[model samples]
Target: MVDVTYNSDLHFEHTLWTSELTFWGGELKSLENRLNELISHWTDKEVLTKLEHYLDEFNLQSNIVRDIQKSIQQHEINILDHTPNGSESMDIPRVKEHLKLRHKMEAQREIYGNLKKDFFLFSSENL
Candidate 1:
């Protein structure tokens, strides 16, 4: 019974932290759009490779980011100790377009923003 009580409390904390990571209208979607533009415009076969890298990175990132989101959902967020962007940077070239998203931490006043706390980047060395 005691364990269950603790677990419930823990879950609430996790939910709160994840809520903050939620994407705002322009932040994450814009980045996705930019990546799509690169995908659409690039004629070279190498574009596939770049796209793969983007996908792979996104795949890996989502797991960790999801955990963070889960924590927020559980109300475990430490807003004061929280790190912005969650990491150093994203390497994807097209990412430059959405750099502005970093500025707005919250999507709405009452709700936490879900703008993907980290940037999604692709390496230039491949191309």
Candidate 2:
């Protein structure tokens, strides 16, 4: 009974944390878009400096989110591993499903990778 309650509490906490992380990600993405737009329109040096500062802060926040996500994912995997009935095979089905979805996302991954690489290469040349 205590174990069940503990597991239930852990699950709820994990869910809440996951949702918060997702919300933060969305907010950060939206903020990035808005900042980009602002940077595009204004040529004032002071404003540009401020925008750069904001971007740095956003990047820091993003890094923190990524770290938290890694921790959360590790915890979730641990919980999955310790399920009742010694159901070790349960994770196999999830892995298979993830693999299937990953295959479907291969194109997206390629496009993103190319764009990211191109952006860095192009930006470096400009600098």
Best by lDDT: 2
Which run of 10 residues does model 1 get worst, by summed lDDT? 96-105
TM-score of 1: 0.37
lDDT score of model 1?
0.41
RMSD in Å for candidate 1, one decimal?
Answer: 16.1
lDDT agreement of model 2 with the native = 0.59
Residue ranges of candidate 1 with Cα displaced over 4 Å: 1-20, 23-26, 75-127
Per TM-score, the best of the predicted structures is 2
Off by over 4 Å in 2: 1-5, 82-127
lDDT per residue as tens, model 1, 1-127 = 3211233333343355345455432344455566676777677777766664564544444454565454343322333223245432223321321222222223332222222322322334433
* lDDT for each residue of candidate 2 in 1-127, tens digit (9 for 90 to 100): 3212344555566576667667767777876787688779878787677676666666666676676667667756765765666443334444444344334335433543464455346335532
